[model samples]
Target: MADTTTGSTEQSTVPRWRIVGPGLVVAATGVGAADLVATLIAGQKFGYTLLWCVVVGCVMKIVLVEGAGRYSLATGRTIFEGWRSLGAWTTWYFGPYIVIWGFVYGAAAMAGTGLALAGLLGGLSVTWWGILSGLLGLVLVWSGRYGVFEKVLAAFVGIMFVTMVGAALLTLPNLGELLTGLAPRIPDGGLVNTLALAGGVGGTITLAAYGYWLREKGWDTPSYMRVMRIDNSVAYVVTGLFVLATLVVGAELLYSTSVAIESGDQGLVDLGVVLQDRYGEWAGKLFLLGFWAAAMSSLVGVWNGVSLMFADFMTNLRGGTSEDPDARAGGKWYKAYILWLTFPPMVMLFLGKPVWLILAYGVLGAFFMPFLAITLLWLLNTDRVPREWRNKLHSNVLMVLCALAFLALCVNEVRKAVVGA
Candidate 1:
């Protein structure tokens, strides 16, 4: 499968610990503040009963991401390239999906970052803050240097881990109950919540960007498979820990109390205020900072990673391969998407998201996970990837389960969007 389209062949001599770039970027990017809020809500509603779901979510992500990385390394191809090999239909599905997904997601991510900054600094409109956040992300990713982008994402992940996990520890949750949460007993009336927490933790379209990051990190050959697997596992384990800690905070801090918070990003602000009143101002501010880190990390992650994917997609759209200059980092298509993610979305900040746009975004977004799962299953099982890297029976089982799980979630989301519309 090695071909001229595959780029440089530099083998990684760095130890596994030092080879943690793309995995961390993908993992951090996947766990935005919204994910934290979902985990918090899970804890609030069901206490430790659904902690097992968080673990399940993390495992599922690891499986899917690892499959993506494995395919890229084994075949020396981008995920986009693999999808194209599937058929022209994949291109048709992805083309409009990415455009719509980006416009909606850009606004959502910027707003999320703005909400965090507004909560932390105060005295500023969230819309303006969101605009500023989008601009900052633009500048950061516009450089097109993967090394710098990875480091920035790493710093943000550090802040998020410290603040969130620290807050959870401060709550001093019961170890016994936390352990029992691993037993997988769903509480009464907790089906949807259980599915969401199990299937939704740290999940996003960015998971598909793992292979791009792996290529950027120079892990583009089959020899790097073990390292890729290790990197993916470690990264999601950290992701799971961060998410679990947030659950602890919700269970100990909110579940036991009578305090009620609103839904969405604003709910996080409400929780921060509760922390201030109950645990003192410092605790609240720390959580707010963590929230900002989560949001900003996601912004940076998507800005860099998705732009790379878009570049690859554009290259393939024009009959060029992943090795085309336009598909690489700092290429024209890469910068173009950076601008798209930054500027156009700012309009939503001022005009507010249109009802139709929201409906379209929701409908398109609902299909991405299952789309990714089904594609991965197909690409991996076929001759597109080397036989050595083909999905094992266990892997195939997990992929099938992942597909079914995301399909169910997709149906649920579509139902909500249609009903809400």
Candidate 2:
């Protein structure tokens, strides 16, 4: 099959601990500084009252990612290929989406990395740091292969795991409260935070890119199904814990004082200052480093992963035959999109984001998660995939829940963008 990996079926028997492939890539890519701020703001606002949403969000991503991986393995096709099979309308939606989302997200991701660096080293302006970060991401992914990219991303995840969780521990969470947080509850006026926690934070276009990463990792066939499940489950569980740790910091450190942070990415920078004031300088410096790692990882991951998706999209749009993502990993289209992600968006850094562009980015960005959930429901439940590999009842239920949740989030995102709220 065009999509089959070169690896043998026996490879799946390797121990679960050794199975940390595309799952980690997807997870790290999904959790950027914006996600941290979202969770941090949630913690600031509602304390642990919305903690259950973290677990729910993790499971939601797991199901969506697993369904995406399963479709690829079972059908020996890419997710883009699966989407194409649905109809030309899928192409219409995806074309505009990938273009606009890439343009806006490139600038946002670059600026995020720059913000962390500016916090870490007070010498350079954020605009220069942001431009450098984009250039750095381009340099990192422009040449390296998948294995090298994965290893770099793993290092970033290590920094993310230690620093965020360390901050949580520093706050000395209330054990009783931590336990109580596991119960589902929503505070007053927390409806948006509740939905954002469940659907938005630590997830986005990267979840669907799981399949592309799988192909790159040589887990491209159904024989690796068990391993894929293990990878997906373990990665998101870690992400959930990381988020829980962020909430702990919010609830234990900031919530009690009723401190307010500047909205958006500046909120995380505000956190570094608090850490410095309360725990001394090392804690603050470490958190800043971790923040840089998180932002840079997302930047690099998108530089690689989304470019792969765009490559596949372009190839399919040209009526090209099915091709393995790894086969075209750094091909012309991949390189072109990488350049697009790196350079053109830099203008936004200096001139500031245009209101219309921001609106398009928000509305389109909000629509994507629900789009993936609904389409996966369509693709996996039908004869499009083999009956044995089709979504089981539990899978169907989780995906339905994901669709509904994200749809609510979609409405909220659009409303907020439209009104500048």
Candidate 3:
């Protein structure tokens, strides 16, 4: 499994700090504005009792995402191709889901980004910002290659990491309780909440986008595996800290204040107000700005990364190539999905999401992580990759745990959504 980049081997020597590439972008992309509000609410409602869940969530995703990148670099094959080797059913599940998910998710994500902007601009409504942000994503992705995209996203990660963590530091939380959160205990009635937080913290279908990002980053070979591992560890470590900081904010401010936060983006807005009251107006504004950066990073990330994913999916379906031409950003299939993601779903914005569509998205989306885990478990262990690069016993155990966690979380989500549990 190897790739020859556009330059000589000397170009491969990236700086340690600048090694934050696709993994960081994908991880940042996966954690949306809504997720921040969710984590904050969880912290507020339960204090840091759920903090361990965030760490678990990061670990679980690291296994899955690192596996995805390893599979690609080790096999010299696209994740779509790797999945195809498993069987046709992989294509079937991925095809419609990518299309439908792209349509609905584009609107939802843009709206989420827009909500954060609207919070900043007191008079502006979300719909206007949603349209603007969508167009901005379109233009940025349309104009740049993967390197440019990675740099911009990394900057956003910096903004998000600094402000949230800085605010958390200011609160001066109880160190003892914070340390206790590392012990992995589930508080009363917290079983479902713990699972949800564990599954939700920086975990999303964007994990699949890792391979595409790896390819884009020129890490398309087995030698890049060590670098990929380092890249992934650093990315998730940053994510873990961001999640911890959110937990700290929840524990220190909302928990003791008895502040009740609503679900969705408004909860973040309310949290911002709470920040203003406690830390000062600038603190609230800064938090919201950071919140917007986090949300928009995810937006730009998905807009660019997942569009690459859908392009590959479409290319594979038509028996076309995913490299050199069709797979590049601004290529035919990539732009097509970008349009698919940005435009058609606007109908949902006004008409309200059709119940069936919502159900399908939930059912399909809920099971994707399990699907990814199971597929990678099989794909990586096979001759598709050299034995040396294949999963060791310890890696397999982590993946098995990932599969089971996703399986349980999927069942919980399905039942909860369908039966109103």
- For each candidate, give its TM-score against the true structure: 0.96, 0.96, 0.95
What range of 10 consecutive residues in model 1 has the weakest lDDT sum?
Answer: 1-10
Error of 2 at 323 (Å): 1.4
List the pairs of residues colliding in candidate 2. Answer: none
> Better model by TM-score, 1 or 3?
1
Better of 2 and 3 by TM-score: 2
- Kindly give the stretch of ten consecutive residues in candidate 2 with the minimal lDDT sum: 1-10
Question: For residues 253-281, what per-residue lDDT tens digits would candidate 3 score against the true structure?
Answer: 98978988788878888888889998899
lDDT ranking, high to low: 2, 1, 3
Candidate 3 has its poorest 10 consecutive residues by lDDT at 1-10
Tens-place lDDT per residue, model 2, 1-421, is 0122344455646765669878989999999988888888888988889999999999899889989999998898989989999999999999999999999999999999999999999799988899999999998888638998999999999999999999998888998988898899888999999999887546699988889888888878788887788788888988898889989998988898898777788888999999999999999999999899999989999999999899899987877855844336778888999999989899999999999999999999999999999999999989999888887778888889999999999998999999978
| Evaluation by lDDT, superior candidate among 1 and 2 | 2
